[model samples]
Target: MSTTYLNLARKWRSKNFDQIIGQQLSVRMIKNSLYLNHFFPVYLLAGQRGCGKTTTARVFAAAINCANLDAFQKNPRLTSLPCLSCESCKAMEQGNHPDFIEMDAASHTGVDNVRQIIEAASLLPLLGKKKVYLIDEAHMLSKAAFNAFLKILEEPPSSVLFMLATTDDQKIIDTVRSRCFQLFFRAIAQNDLRGLLVEICQKEEIGYDEQGLQLLIRETGGSARDALNLLEQVRFSSDQITEENVLRVLGCISDDQICTVLYHVFSKAKSPQKLIEYVDEIKLESFAPEIVWHRFIVALKIAVWYKYGVSSTGLVLTNDLKASIEAVPLSQAVRLFDFACQQEQLFLKTIDKHLFLSMFWIRLWSMVHNQEAEITSLVTSKSMVTASIDSKLTVTDQLVATSEQQRVTISANSSLWEMFLEQITQVDDQLIVSLFTQAKLKNYDTESNKLEVSFHKKFELFQDLFTKKDAPWFLLLQEVFGNGIQLNPVFESESIVQDVKPIEKKVVDQSKKQFYQSNNSANVSKKDIPLDISDKTAWAMTHALLERFPGTVTEFKEETDE
Candidate 1:
């Protein structure tokens, strides 16, 4: 075969408005204007590559001055159908039209180049009723060139029509864009691209599997030109186009292999070694890690969509594969998807892709498995604790019923301390519970109504906090043991006194000074001090501040001056 043979993209170039793909809005607007013989002096068609902007402009140009345009004006539906036999239409098709001028603004971007077009716009057409100037990549024109052509582009001669096509509309100045009737083109749909590919294969007498054609459509990202070009390459390489051939040619992982990887990753019986084996198999098949990772995410997303009752047409997977993917919890699938995305950017920049991929899989596996194990352990522990607590409450209820016959006496030390722990647990005071766990009930006196507790050297810092005569801990202790009971906190080591001595005196002096000054007295004896409930409540509020503000209360004082 000679290289001179036309490629699929050129061979199947859209000749009329109806033949153009994925440009229905632009086509409808232009065709309606053509039908009414109402032409804009300047028209801007904008979109990405291979989206039919220039082709639509050319077709509209030929249709504007077609020999049989009268027939089209009579029937609105037939306006886009230009007569190919007309002299002007044939010239436009051959790229030799006298009335239809196509200028690539990319190459001719200077003011001199635009000036020529502006000068030519005043002349009369040699071959047709309207002279058309189609400028592709119009955004490439320089600022001076755009400024030079701005006047003529806004309001041109009666016989002249200007058509501009660009991939980026933002690059074009607003003043120039405002003057033109702008229409936007979009990417071709996968379904439409598939149908076009099928028609091309049928016409070219090429054999292609359904999956292979679908893969081509996906790889092209909805570009008709790109799909056709890929199709031509596949056809030239082999007589039969299969999934394996498409994967090999595109350097992508096959859908089956992708399904296999995800199945093992999310399966209940999944093991780390099994996942590693799958990665090795993919590596042996010459698949790039980045492509494999991308395919995994795509397949995982499709499964998630299906799980949520959304459309899953694009994905090609077996029933077993579908079931395996659906077995993954939605939360886990979402988390893995997020993690894979984070790793994707890193994978691209790393020098050792395979090593990076292996590390990523191992990290993901460990995190997922550890999370499942922790959740299971937490549930089991909660259930066991609930059962034990229920059994204990049953016995305590029976004991309470017999309280009149045999009074239940709560000991002032261990038994009362246990009750305090239970009360704080009921109130959800976890910080209090943690501190009490390290304390030891040393003694209790009935005559003086005093209770003493000992703490290890580590808890010496918090001893004075709980030892306050009206602290919340003392209140709870007195309520459980008896009213008027004082709490004496004892440290196990004398060295703790030195460590805590600096702040202890500061707190005592400030509290004593504040209390004495409030009574207008310098001396207040312990016997003369009335231990009223209201006074205890006030001290309790101060201790509450100690717990609230933490380290700041080492030397107690109010935060805001009121």
Candidate 2:
């Protein structure tokens, strides 16, 4: 209060609902609620940092608890907004109100701390009729603390009002969230911020360059508090606030420097070397790597936008930079931007910043070089292609036929299976090859013009694939051969084995032979049959038992006639 200077963010913080910016709809709804006397017991204000969640909460707390509201309510013509001169409003504004409680859950994030609030809610208001509890950063409350506070929030006393403000509303407990009415605050736009900054500068009588203010607007990323803080830094740096002064103070790159770096990246043949030189030059000027990287990314985006005729707002660039940016191809610009973003992620993870950045520039340069080489090779190949067409006419003539007219004649010596496998591997990898190779080539009937393929019972997956009319594999087979080739897929069925008389066993012991004969009497139970688990014929029965019965394996039998 004694200091000559007051920061713009603090001095301009909204004191009443009418002064709140960028949240017109939210503010209007809150005001309407007050006018209708339909105040909810608990209210939740959610938004990003510096978007005025806490500020709005404080103003709403003051308005609802203002002692003068009764008189204003009686006279409908008078303003229902909070009168700052009233006893309750002044106490709230000065942070001395006994009824208004502001608890920052970030520091006090325990069950016991929340218990204190629950205990205090039982007491009557000391100065005003309503007790306002403003819990900022409410998401930071511990789970146990939220559970303890949930009851009070769900059914608070009629004299109490709970206002919870948080940046991340999702972190708040669902039960607690459902009990409260929610309001969302949005970030202030660039134009709104610019107007506010211009007004502040005019009010403070501070000389500022228009471009310099624009830079501050972009740097702050639409946060009014951040913008004001940055403006204060720039205003303190020099007498006149100019773009160069702002860049110097903030350790940001200038537009010309950014353009110089990008132009060398796009126009110079040895881009990596040029980029290295420019980076060194910028470092010598004391530009931070992060700032340089941010500016470089912005410049690359401008190039992309310029190339595609898209607008790049809130950025003031020189005509030369715009021209150079517009000249780059959209694809190259996008690639460079994407590469920079990828490198930036890596840069954030590594401890060795210098080496990573150097390698990043080198990689970018190599990408450009590779693309240039590819383009050159494509052009060269196109020019030489016409010259070789006459020599390759015989080979080309056989391969270039319309789908309906093409007929591939296979030699008698050629193995159809080998040709099909070779063509399959070209289109797909080993996965598809493994799936198809299981099918046995039954026969290629030249007279019927059908390719008969038989699959084992275990290879039924291949049969299913071939049955699809529009599967890629089928189309690929037709393309490799001719459209006239018809595919006939067959699944070989398992045949039942008839009963065979058991061979006479060599009698080991008289008792053992008699016991075996009794167990295998004329009427033999299915479970009494000796199991041949190792035989391939028993696999299906074993699998069925394992799938149906799971763990119990009392008996396993071979295929038998029904």
N/CA/C clash count, model 2: 0
Work out candidate 2's RMSD over C-alphas: 14.3
lDDT of candidate 2 over 1-562, digit per residue (tens) = 6865658888888898767778888888887777777799999999888878998899888888876666646663568578898898889877899999999999999999988988889999988878999999999999999999888888899999999999999999898999999998888888888888888899889899888888888887768888888888888888777898888888887877777766666653434545787778777347666877777788778777777777776355666666655554455567678778877887878886666766666666544443343333444565478558754445554445322122222222124456667768654334456556666566555446587766657656545456665766776666433355688877776532324676555644676878987666664434445544565344654654455357644454433334
TM-score of each: 0.64, 0.64
- Mind sharing the TM-score for model 1? 0.64
List CA RMSD, all candidates.
Answer: 15.6, 14.3
Q: List the global CA lDDT of all models.
A: 0.73, 0.73
Residue 213 lDDT, candidate 1, scale 0-100: 91
Model 2: worst 10 consecutive residues (lDDT sum)? 404-413
Model 1 agreement with the true structure over 37-109: per-residue lDDT tens digits: 8888899998888878877888888888898788888976634478798888888877888888899999999
Candidate 2 Cα misplacement greater than 4 A, ranges: 1-6, 70-80, 268-270, 314-332, 371-562
Query: For model 2, what is the alpha-carbon lDDT of residue 378?
Result: 45
